[model samples]
Target: MRWFEIALVVLTLLSGLVWLLDKLFLAQRRAAHAGLLDDGRDPWYVDYAKAFFPVLAIVLVLRSFVAEPFRIPSNSMMPTLLTGDFILVNKFAYGLRLPISNAKIVPIGEPERGDVVVFKPPQHPEQDWIKRVIGLPGDTIEYKGNQVFVNGQPFGYERVGDYVGVGSGAEMTGASLLTERIPGRPHQVLEVDRLPFVDQGERGAQVVPAGHYFVMGDNRDRSDDSRFWGFLPEQNIRGKAFLVWLNCDSITNLCKHNFDTSRIGNRIP
Candidate 1:
């Protein structure tokens, strides 16, 4: 959820509490000012809040439990997703869970091998990351010289020629565009020699334990992901990104700003 949504929830709760306190404790003083008898009763603030509290609480419940909107902030999932892509994440698709404290209250389907998932960073729960699931629980993942191996078998790959990333990702122009098979799933990934797989603090392979997943970015060298940090816990999952509502990174196209018609209604894998 965004900061504005967080603020709205906090303010709404505070407002409701204040109104309740005023009605329960200071009702006589408030009613006197409102030209009412000094009998312990509802205050003007309480009356107004009665109508507002339900509406605010409903919004909070629906947004936090039903569905949540998120924007792609980086090129980690590029070729499949780009920067500034506004997407909707199904908050309950994984199962219903209480907001803020992401404890899953219901059981749902687990993430697949090639699924692009959004979750809180294990290194920093405050930070959120989106990436492709490469290794599931109990899977051994190995990345050697740009090749990915899961359970000692290399994920299939096919060269798809050069990738021309527009706007911010233009730096990856002429990078090798390859079709990578993450076991049963196949997706496009970019490999740029100009951008070497510098350790950039990312090192080592991890043996995924039960209820954990190892993720990696499609932009192999550009993203700061599990390779650098670690696996994402099942509880940290937010949802699958499934759309690109809009993309307007450079100001040169402001007047023409709108949905990327080609990307609209596209299913995210």
Candidate 2:
């Protein structure tokens, strides 16, 4: 589990325990005494717990079951999602999952082709990664000549002029920007056409096994996606990404100067 998740869970539990113990045992004893010498005051930990328990529980429930905010840290999903874009991932869109364990409690829906999903990649299970679903289970996927071919059929691409990103993303300026029609969803992708279309010795085609998914990034050459680390297991899926709520395009500095509001509140494709 991530450090933030672990810490949040531990703190919430500890505070809740303190609040419960005080209410059941300590509170009554203090009330029985009821003297000027014994003021109606809780211990420091109890006071802190009573004040923060409600807030912490609410946050844990909302973030675990409703939606969670995540910042775009890489250009892998560029043109569609820029670096520093704060996106909301629909937790229940896939299903209700345990916060730290990430075990699905209910199977509400399955991932489809073209859905942008945040999942734990096989390479680094601890880190959360976002990528578009390319091939579903039992389907053949291919990456050749900088184009995606699913089930031996190539998807269509619509040229969308040159990609001119703002803030720190300007480094990828002038890259080929095009709309890739991945069946149901047509989203923009960036490709460096000036360079040769290479797969770095990776296979041109592979069949997605059961309970696994094939995903790729919008920035074809820049993303560290399933194209390199292999298929994403179904258990690793965290949620489906849907909206961009904020944009601050600085990594190290963080909202120091590149906080743009134009992309805020935009629904992700």
Candidate 3:
């Protein structure tokens, strides 16, 4: 369980307990002693519980099942999603899961090819990683010469232009930008020139097992994704990223106000 999740649970429970105890036991006592007190002030704990309970509950519900905001920390997504982009992930888009446990209890919808998803990497489950889904369950995926082949058919791509990076993404300038057509969805991807496309030692085609997905970064050569580690388990998926609400550079430094207004309110493709 994450520390933030633990904190939410603890705060919610503590506030609720205080409220209940006050309502059941303390309220009557205060009412009986109402005439004796000068100002008739409520207990500090009761006041605090009353003030915080509703706010905490609302935040917990929204963050755990509705939607949550995440800041992009890397340029692996490049042309699709740049670093410092603050994105909103739809928590219930796939299914509602118990927050910390990540156990999906409801059946909503499964991830489709080309959907941008945030999931815990199989090798490093502690960190959250976002990538575009390239292959679904039971599908064979291949990477050759910087092109992705899904189910024996090569995914089509059209050269858009040369990518000009901005802010934190300036390091990836001059990459080839292309619109990749993945069946129903067409999105932008960045391909660096002269980079190897093989997935470690496992060359040729590989089949995606049930309850798992094949994903890759839009910046093909830069991302350490399923190509390097392994498949993303369905249980580890946090949510589908759908929107970029804000973009701010220097989150760690806090020295400059480098907000990219152009990316605000942009929908994720």
Candidate 4:
């Protein structure tokens, strides 16, 4: 996807440059000559540039600022988001940003605890990972007994039942499912049986530095997030992942399609 982003920007720029140069320079030259030795036909490259420039530019702007689509390749967000789920991320939810660099150009909002976000992890900036915000800047966060504590107040959790994963998430079956309350929203998190006690001691209660956040996956035990890689830097955020638009799992593969239409349009909690 990063490669796709780079390709999109490069194609858009190349096409737009060709079209602009033709309109401002080559076109005028062709008109001035009229029939001198020319048949008044634009070059093939210019024709291609003129045809593709607008479409490429429109897609680039929309994807860079309005919204963008992403496919979940792992079960890190299982139950909330399944592997093969296609989600639409709100690109300007936190702020407007440049396309490839992801540098914020305008301020709109900050990530609240519990917001699902897609970001470049500090340890692996080339990959995009999604997780729920657990701690804001200056707040202390901890994970113990399969529950999250923020600022010394543990988040409310109610056991739902045993989880039953499907498709790519089948490995998570038999995990304990519970609803956790944070940032005024209630969302489910999974606690696997293999994990015993998760007492991080001093590391669990670490304070989130300014411009950084603590994030964790809904699949609590399986995710490698802030608990493993450290706090998420504000600059690494790509956008808020707010919606799951499609789910195309292995059930839909092997030359046959079995997309789960029911998961479509579900808002990420």
Could you give candidate 4's per-residue lDDT for residues 20-91 as a string of tens digits? 999999999889878767777899999999999999999999999999999888988878999988899999
lDDT of each: 0.77, 0.88, 0.88, 0.88
Candidate 4 residue-wise lDDT at 139: 96
Against the true structure, what is each candidate's TM-score?
0.81, 0.94, 0.93, 0.94
Residue 242, candidate 2: alpha-carbon lDDT: 96
Candidate 3, residues 68-97, lDDT tens digits: the string is 888888989988898888999999999999
Give lDDT: candidate 1, residue 99. 69
Worst 10 residues of 3 by lDDT: 194-203
Candidate with more favorable, higher TM-score: 1 or 4: 4
Candidate 1 residue 250 Cα shift, in angstroms, is: 5.1
lDDT string, candidate 1, 18-74, tens digits: 777775867666555765555655656677777778788887887777766677778
Error of 3 at 128 (Å): 1.3
What tens-digit string does per-residue lDDT give for candidate 2 at 152-242? Answer: 9999998989988677788888899998987768889998877774464257889999999999889987888888888899999999999
Q: Candidate 4 regions off by >4 Å?
A: 194-202, 251-255
Point out where model 2 deviates above 4 Å. Answer: 34-36, 197-202, 251-256
Highest lDDT scorer: 4
